[model samples]
Target: MNAPQTPGQSLLEVVDLAVDYQLKGISLPAIRDVSFDLRAGEAVALVGESGSGKTTTAMAVAGLLSPNAAVTAGGVRYRGRRLPIDDDDAMRPHRWNDLSVVFQGAMNALNPVQRVSKQIAEPCMLKLGMTRDEATARASELLELVGISAERGAAFPHELSGGMRQRVMIAMALACNPSVVIGDEPTTALDVITQAQILKLLTKLRRELNLALILITHDLSVVAESCDRVMIMYAGRVVEDGTVADIFNNPKHPYTKLLIDSIPDPSTGKRISRPIPGDPPTLQNPLSGCAFRSRCPSAMSICARDLPELGAHEQGRVACHLYPAPAEARGFHQMGEVTNIMALENLQVHFPGRGGMLSNLFGRPAAHVRAIDGVDLTVRRGEILAVVGESGSGKSTVGRVITKLVQPTGGKLVFDGKDMTSVEGLALRPYRHRVQMIFQDAYQALNPRHTIFDIVAEGVRSLHLVSGHEAIMQRVAKSLAAAGLNPPQDFFARFPHELSGGQRQRVVIAGALAVEPELIVADEPVSMLDVSIRAQILQVLIGLRTQRNMALLFITHDLPVAWSIADRIAVMYLGRIVEIGSADDITFNPKHPYTVALRDATPKVRPMINADPLPGLNGEVPSAARIPTGCRFHPRCPLAMDRCRQEEPPVVDVGPHHQSACWLASTSQHS
Candidate 1:
């Protein structure tokens, strides 16, 4: 039986919480001395890099820790009542009824065979003892409450879009009316616009239902927008905790400051992303003193001698030796001069759409998925042009076309004023040697069986850039060092699986650099990495650009990241570039409604407690196979006019070297 509640207590409290994972026969400490309180209607964010114990602490609170995890020290409390979290049987009644968790991947958490409604209704029926009809009715209400129609509740998870599936998870989390809800990277996999919508929905539900929300996320921008209080965890300890403004504006801890600085904020209008030096320490043994001391730029002798207590600071608590020392300002490096490297004129790439055998048998013409309908773009040497959009927007397809991975259906691919559209067979060797592509997932991109040396030298040997094994080794070492892997000899013998995610990505970059490519097509390179690690990767790219004058065709869904590094930003929707301009123009003075929507969806790092909800995009990007008539964005655009639906808008120059393919661009210019 659960303990009786005491009055006037915090809605939820975790006092000196510590967790350990049983690896083999050894107990590896994952979370150490994490303490916080969550009152009703409060939203707190557990912010950290991967393996920072944010998720572990949350799982302990929700009594959803894995079988191998043990609460070695401390405990969780609900309304002053101690929870037997480690005891699964004892936590049965409290799970989902009082505390609930919306896992990271909705598809993985939800049952594949069962309907979404049935999954949501299962908790309602089992926990609340509601009849089948009652549960079904409640499920329908919840589905509508989270913006999904009740009629679509019968659809399988695969049938819904990524955004809709995430909504279903939210609805299911609220099925039993749980007072406290824990969202574990709920919006990590979503697009910026979709993420904005989900965050808006979560905030609204938290206020309306008077529920306490705990969000575990690595994205600090998301935290600043949705959370009231923020906790910065490093290694396995809560290094800092304070209000959003206090933490973001005046952080005392080095790790906290570095994390905030690492994030690429488009609103800042400065391309400054400094990565923290060194990697996170391993938890094989209990750490002494400060776990972040090795990586701390301002680490003192005292820090190594003793661990700092979470003492009261200015407006919150911080576990750091430097209590009041302000963070030093860093210099921002400007990108050098740029010239034309490549250009695409009316680029078009189309794949055969899924037309079943019946259509072919009926002698009907097959349809094509217009991945890249018609895009006119340019890449300049020593500059980064970011292509930003949601999935199916065809930004990635443009990169593939440039790399010759995907043959263009029509139009021309020009490099250095030379048309390379029909370049094929052995004739394309020079083009391949000049252009290299870096994929999103580095682990999958690299061969698991090959050593780091072999992987890096593969390009050198294939291109025959250098002769002899000694020359190849020298080239590989140089590339590895350039990619920020110092003492390259140490990693030469290691396999992909042996290295960390950041290290693996660095290896991929090293492989690309071994061939000395003139232009690099980086497609979402930093999306899979942590903030600190991402900063490192971004710095490496910027360094390479500075040293080699290498042009980059950077493609990503993150607008802030694009704005942080790119000299120019291109906004794509459906299969066309809706807006193209300088980063500042695209982010600040957007002419297209789609561009405005994307800018609005980007969460800025600021205090947003009880802030007005974001005006997110209306719906997901339409199917590429079924192209919308006229302007593709008109269907979801808030400022869409009658002409937008009836007539295709022509590209108009809105500013100096800035163009927008929107009817409103002309109207705005005239007005």
Candidate 2:
């Protein structure tokens, strides 16, 4: 904890800055007149969905511009001096010493070749002009300061988990104790506990050193909890800017309002979230006037004439024509429907426990662990059925079972009338195409050496019910376009290595669609993407359902996404669906305590983090290798009684299309 203090006044000032990237013969403006200030001990969060140019702005501020990118207009002043964007040599001295960047994605940001200590010490020895011994000592101190052990400093980037690597990255950024610390989606790779830890570390360090933070993130919850000020960006423009309290309380922009309203709350069952539709305008060919005009709910005829100027409203500001004028919202589907695309009757995934010899001898069936114990559900056609749960709640197992990636121990899966339990081999292949799955990790799911065309076309060629190279390529192009890749001709030839994380995911989605699948099982599809692009990919899924009538089984720990997208929500606890209902019923009038706990744990735009969600779903999800007895959640259930430990409660229907598998829900109504 002996890392040197970061000092100085209003640490960094980015005023009227506009940046452009050299593309072929054209210059594409990436950041447009972005202005912000950061002072010591204050955190300014840049909030936006993907392709908003938040990262480009941050990169410019950090002076990490490639030769391809240049500041087209305005400047970044650090403590009253303008940063030299053109000359790297001129910016060298101030780069790490004044403004240091902690990047997103622990997986990619850290070098595979270097160890954690070495990475931290590399900057220390090189940038800070420290001796090896001094650098090592500082690195150790920094690691400790970031809640990592000095003893584990020797671990390589791969050796440490994602969160640990992020902590290492933070430690490296702080190794020099730079005057200004810029965190770019720093907590994106982490889970809630790890996110909390990282945010706490950043806050502690900022306070201790009086350091200024320009935190870039998509999560409003993070902004609300940690940031003092927020700037909402869209398509390279700041649409809204304000104090967190001001913006959340009085969201002026339609995008801002949708962002706030789309968030989920635990006390309420499920909210009718109005997810903003349409993709952000192509940065390469950005729309004239307001970039958001095409997607804006309050889009007026005049909105197309000229870009709306940033107008003051109370304490904050918004850049929308109808802010002071009332206008009708567009592209929101409030009512959700369920029509049974796939059904699982008593779907159970069980593995044997550790009691080998004695259990075998006594013929106790090796003691089933019940990963998806006796779960029955239906995914309606053209509807999103979000399966919400904490980690280890069997939400993922259910997805895998439906995809036939994992064979269920007991159950009948009726996919458009075909029984999954008895289907196998060639017969299974048909069902596989009918219900495809997209994994959370795009890099791992995709072949590294393959081109975007090859990766996406692989599914088309493999599924081969058709013709020649031209025909296959045509299908590939169509699939890619369907998954949101514009001008498919340009993107098809590109390789995965050449694409960004969001682009890679789109390629995967395109691959999933190439088979012309009726349904997609997305296991945290957007969790790995940047905040800006995450919503875009999610909308792509929703749009697919709306346009092409593709059913989606969205399995995620992210409840807000579920609240926003899911038609029917199934709240899983331990290994079973503790609550099942229409999205309205689940978000507005949740009955199961587990459902309530999950809703509470998840952060919406206006997150109430001060209130603990009746204590952390309490205890680890009972091991799938050796699950507990009776009501599967009895060990952790807040309302568990003696009878609950010995007897399982049947799912009770409290209202139309609402069911909760809790003795409380079932018995409370009777009692």
Candidate 2's TM-score: 0.51
The Cα local distance difference test for each model comes to 0.85, 0.79
Query: For model 2, how does the per-residue alpha-carbon lDDT over 554-628 read when each residue is reduced to its tens digit?
Result: 998877678667777899987888898877677657887777777776657785423335665567677776666
Per-residue lDDT tens digits of candidate 1, residues 1-671?
12333322368878667788988755677987677888888899999999999999999988889999988756777876788898999999988788889889988988888899999999998999999999999999999999999999899999899999999999998988888899999999999999999999999998887778999998898977788999999888889999999999988899998998898878886478888888888777444557889999999986775566676677888888887322210111222223478999999999988777998899787789999999999987667889999988999999999999999999999999899999998998898899999999999999999999999999889878889988888889989988988789999999999999999999999999999999999999999999989977987886576446578889999887887678789999988998999877776677788877776676779632223333666777889988889888888887788998988898999999799999989778778
Candidate 1, 112: how far from true, in Å?
92
RMSD of each: 29.0, 27.8
TM-score of each: 0.51, 0.51
Distance from true location, Cα of 601 in model 1, Å:
2.2
